[model samples]
Target: FTTEDGAVNAGGSLVLFDTATAQQLYLKPGVFQNATVSAEAGVSDRKLLDEITPLLPKDATAQTGKALADRQAKDIESGLTSLNTMLLAFAGIALFVGVFLIANTFTMLIAQRTRELALMRAIGATRRQVKRSVLLEAGVVGTLASVIGFLLGLGLATGLRSAMGLMGGKIPAGPLIVSPTAVGSAFAVGILITVLAAWLPARRAAKIAPVAAMSSVHATASVKSLVVRNSIGGVITLLGSAGIVGGAASGGTSGRQLIAAGAFFALIGVIILIPLLSRPVIALVRPALKKVFGVSGKLASQNAVRNPRRTGATASALAIGLTLVTGISVLGVTLGQAIDKMTTDNIKADYMVSMASGDSLDESALRALSKADGVTALSPQQAAWFEVDGEYHSASAVTPGDVEQVFSLTVESGSLASLKDGQVAVGSKTAKENGWKTGDTLPVKFDDEKKGELKVGAVYKENEFLSPFVIPKELADEHSASTRPEIREIWIKADGGASKANEQAVVDALGDNPAMSVMDRQDIRDMFGGFINTALNIMYGLLAMALLIAVLGVVNTLAMSVFERQQEIGMLRAIGLDRGRVKRMVRLEAVVISVFGAVIGVGLGVFLGWAIGRTLSADIPGYALVIPWDRLGVFLLLAALVGVLASLWPARSAAKLNMLTAIKTE
Candidate 1:
C-alpha cells in the first residue's frame, strides 16, 4: 500500500509501494494511526496490511486525544522531576551554607555577650531561659532571611527561564509559578537550619555559670574544641570515603556509587575536614605572604586560622556551590568545545539547505540550485538513523569531493587520493579510541539486515563535525541497490561573503519548497547549539548568586568576629589600634575566609572536573582537567575584594565601640 499528500500534508491515507517495480498501489482512501510512524516498509508486505485495513485516518478525535494525553503527562512528569532534582541540589548547598553561617554567627553573638548572659544568669534568669532567648532571636532572623531568599529565588528562576528561552530551549511550560508546596518547604528548611545552627551554642549558653560566662571562658578553649571536633569529623569522613570507594569498585549499587560513594563522600569530607585542612594549607603560605604581602597579609592569615569554625563556615558556603557549579560548567564547556569542533567537521559546506520535513532533493533540485548566481560548489548528504543492539545510531552518506574544499580535513595516515578504495573511513579519534587499525576488518550493521564489512583503508583526522564516514558514491549505490535518499541536505559555496547574493537567489529559486530550512555557516552556532548556551547562562547566574552568598557569609562571619572582639578592638583603638589597623584586621579576616574558600573550591573544581572527563572522549578525554587558570586568578582577586568589602562595615562597627563599654560588657 502507498499514499502521498502532495498539498494537504494535513492528513493522509495508508498506501503501499513496490521497490523493484517502482509502483505505488493505493488500496483505498484510508488513514491509519499506529504506535510508531512508518518511515519505510520492513518484512511485512502491503498485501497483509491492505487486507485488514480500514478507510480512515484513525479517529480524528481519538488521535488528537491520545497525543494530548501523552504530551501533557510527559511534560508534567518530566518538568516536576527536573525541578525536584535541581532544587534538591541547590537546597543542599544553600542549607549547608546556612548551617555554617547560623552556627558561626550564634557562636560569635554568644561569645561577645558571654558576660551579659552570665550576668543574666547571675540574676534571676534560668539557663533554659537564656538559651531560649537566643533561640528566639535566631528564629526571627532565619525566618526573615528565608522569606526574602525564597522570593529572590522565584525571581531568579524566572530570569533563568528567560535566559534559556533566548538560547532556544524549552523550559517548563506555562508561567513558572512559585508552588505553594515549594514555599512551605523552603520555610521549614529555613527554620530547621536556624534551630540546628543555634543548637550547640544554646547548650553552651545553658552550661555557662554567671561569672565564668562573663569571663569569655565558654569560648576561651573554643580553639581546642575546634581541633577535637574537626578531628572526629575527619576520621568519620575518611572512613566513609574508603567504604564508598571499595564498595563501588566491587560493583555495588550505582545509586550509592555515584552519590554516597562519590559525590556525598567528597562533599562530607571537605566540609568536615575544612578547618583542619585550612590550618596546614594556610600555614605554608603565612611566611611567604607575611614578608611581601604587608601587614594586611599577616593579619589575614592570622585571622583565617584564629577561629576554625567561623573560617570553615565562611569557606564552606563558596565550596558547596562552587563544587557543583564548577562541575557542571566544566561539563558544559567541554561539550561546547567538543560540539563546535564537531559542527565544523560534519558540516562541510558554506551553506546548508534542507527540507524542514526532510524531503528528498534529487539531482534536478541540486542543478536548479546551482544555476543561481555565484553558486560555485555544492555537496549533498543523506542521513538515516537506526538502532542496533538497543543502541541508537546514525549513518550519513555523503559525496563531497569538495568536503576538503568545504570543511577541510587533514589526512593523518591514508591519502584522499585513495578515496575510491571501497573501504570505510573512520575519524582518527573514533579509530584510535576503538582500537581500530588500517586494513582491519570493520563490521558495520546498517539498519537491521544490511551489513558492510569494509576494510579500514586509512584513519583520517576529522577536525570538523562528522559521524562515521562512508564509501564513495558508486560503491554506496551498488551496496544499497541505488536506494534514493529520502532526505537530502545541500551545502553551497559561493564566490562572495557567505554568498549573500547567491543565498538570496537560491532562496528565490526554492521559494515554493515550503518544507526547507536554510542556514549559512554563521547561523550554525546559534541554531545548532542554542540550548547549550542557555544552560550555561543559567549556570553562570546561579554561580553568581552563590558567590554573592559566599560574600554574605564572609560578612556575617566577620561582623560576628568584630562584635566578639569589641573589647579587643576598643583596647587597640585606645592604645594605637589604628582605625586603619582595625579595618585592616577585619578586612584581613575577610580575605582569610575568601582565600580559604578559593583554594578548596578551585581544588575541588579541578579534581572533580577531571573525574567528570572520564565520562566523555570527544575532547580531552581520560580526566581532561583544566585549571581554568584565568578563572582561578579572577576568583582569588574577587575573594580579596570581597574580604575588604565585607570587612568595611564591621570594621567601622568594631572601631566605634567604646573601650570602657566594651570592657564593662563582659
Candidate 2:
C-alpha cells in the first residue's frame, strides 16, 4: 500500500507502519557503506579522520574533512585557481599597458606645470619636498581607486561564480570570501604602479632651474639611450630567434614551452624597437597619404611622427594585445583545418562503431549489427602492441576483405590478398625505415610470450588511421593467449551508401547498446575539432580583456595629446581650420597609429603561428600551414573601429576648446 498523494501530485508522500512490528528492509548506523565507526556528537572531524587514517592502506592518500566537503572544496579550489590565474594574468597585462598611460599623463602634466614647480623651487621648496609632494598625491589617488576597484571585484566574482557552474564546475555556495591577502595585494599593487609611473616625471620636475622657469622646452631622447635600447633589443631578438629554431628541431612539451618563451621574447624585442622604427615607417607611409587624402592626411601623418617616442609607446600598447589575439586565432584556425583535412583525406569508411575506452564490443552485438539492414560490409579490428627489435610499436589486425570494402589502400608493390596467417602489411614509410620489402620475414613478438616471424604482405601509403604494421586477424587470433579477442572498432559500408542514411541505420540497429556510438567521418572530426575551438574561444575571451585595456591606452594618449597641443589647436582654429577638420585630423592620427600597430602585430603573429604549426606537423603527419585571411581582414577593420572609438572623446574635447583662452595660455 502507498500514500494517496504521490510526488508529482502536489503533496508529500506518507508511509503507514505498525508502531511495534513494522520492519525496514535494511538498516545502517552510518551514512557511508565502508565506514567502521561514526564520530560522536562531541568528536571533532579531524580526530575521526586521524583515527580512520591508520585503518586505511599505508599507500592510500587521504585528507581530513567530511568526504563530500573535502571533494567539494577541492573541486571549487581547483576551478578558482585556474580561473583566478587567467584573470590575474589579464589584469597584469592591463596594468602593464596602463604604465604607458600613467607615465605619459604625468609627463604631460609636469610639462604643463613647469612654471609652477620652478616658482616653488625658487621660493622655499626643496627638490626632495617637490618629489615627495607628487608621490603623496599619487598615493592618495591610488588608494581611493584601489578601494573602489576592490569592491567592484566582489560584484564581478559573484557573477563569475554563476559562470563557473555553466562551465561544468561544481562550486559549493557558502559565505563570500574576502581574504586580507587579496585586499592588501590589490592596494599594494595600485600604490606601487602609481609611484613607479610618477617617478620619472617627478624627477624631471625637481630638476627645473629657477632661472629657466620662464622658458618652455622639452628634452628629446638622448643618442646614448637610443644606442643602448637598440643593442639590448637586438640581443633579445637574436636569442628569441635561436629559441624558435631550437623549438622547431625539438619535440613534445619542452618544444612547446620553448616556442612560447621564444614568442614572448620576440614580442618584447619588437616593442623595444617600435620607437626606433616609427619615424622611418611614418616617412614611408607619408607619400601614400599625401597622394590619397591630400592635405588633411599629410597633416595627420605629420602629427603622428612629430612625437615619435609618444607615438611608438601608444602603438606598442595596442601591438602587444593584438599580437596575442592574432597568434591564438592563427593557431586555432590551423588546428581546425588540419583536423578537417585529416578526416577528409585519410578516413574512407562510411560509418564507424566504437566502444567506450577499455570496453570490449560484444560478439553477439557485432553479429546482430552485421545483419542489420543496408550493412553490406563490416570490418572488426583489434589494436595490439608488438615489440620489434626491443622497441614497441602499435598495430591493428583486420581481415583482408575489410581493407578492400572500407579502406583506400595504396599498395606499392604487393596485393592485399597476400595478407594471410602469419603475415602483415606495413606502411611504405615504415617499410623504408625498417629496410623491409614485400615477402621479407620480420621477427615480431607480442605480450604473453607470443613470438613469430611474419612476412610483409604489402606496403601501403602512410595515413592517419593506417598503423605502421597491420597484421591479419587470423594470425593474431592463432598466436594470441586470450580466450576472447576483444574488438574495439568496426568499420561499416552500406549497400546504397550515403553517410547520413548509413549512420541512421547503424544507430537504429545498435538499439539500446549504451556502450557503443555510431559516427561518420565528419562526426569524428567534430569530436576533436570542437575541443580546439572551445579552447580558442576561452583564450580569445581572455585576450579581449587585454585588448580592452590597450584601447584605454589609446584613449589616454590621445587625451594627453589634446591637452599638450591646446595652443596649436587654437591657432589652427583661429586661422580658419573648422571644428570638423580638427576632429578629422585627430581621428586620422589615431587610425594611422592603430594601423601601424596592427600591421606589425599581424606580421609577427603569422610568422610565430606558422613556425609553431610546422613544428607540430612533424608529429601530427598531415597538418599544413593555414592562414585565415578573411579573419585578419576583419581584425584590421575592428582595429580601425577601435581607433575611431578611442579618439571620440579626445577629438571632441579638442574641437570644443576655447580658441581665445587656449592661444593666450602659457
lDDT of each: 0.67, 0.77
Per-residue lDDT tens digits for candidate 1, residues 289-381, read 678756656876887888776688788887876776666666666666666656765555668887666456755666677677777676566
lDDT of 2 at 641: 92
Regions of model 1 farther than 4 Å from truth: 1-76, 115-141, 144-180, 207-211, 221-224, 236-260, 280-300, 328-335, 338-351, 354-365, 372-377, 385-393, 400-488, 492-534, 618-624, 658-665
Give the CA lDDT, 0 to 100, for residue 147 in model 1.
90
Cα deviation at 328, candidate 1, in Å, is 4.1
By summed lDDT, which 10 consecutive residues of candidate 2 come out lowest?
A: 24-33
Cα RMSD (Å) per model?
8.5, 7.5
- Candidate 2, 481-560: lDDT as tens digits: 55456677788878876566666778878885666887776787897688989988888887777678778878887898
**How do all models score by TM-score?**
0.71, 0.79
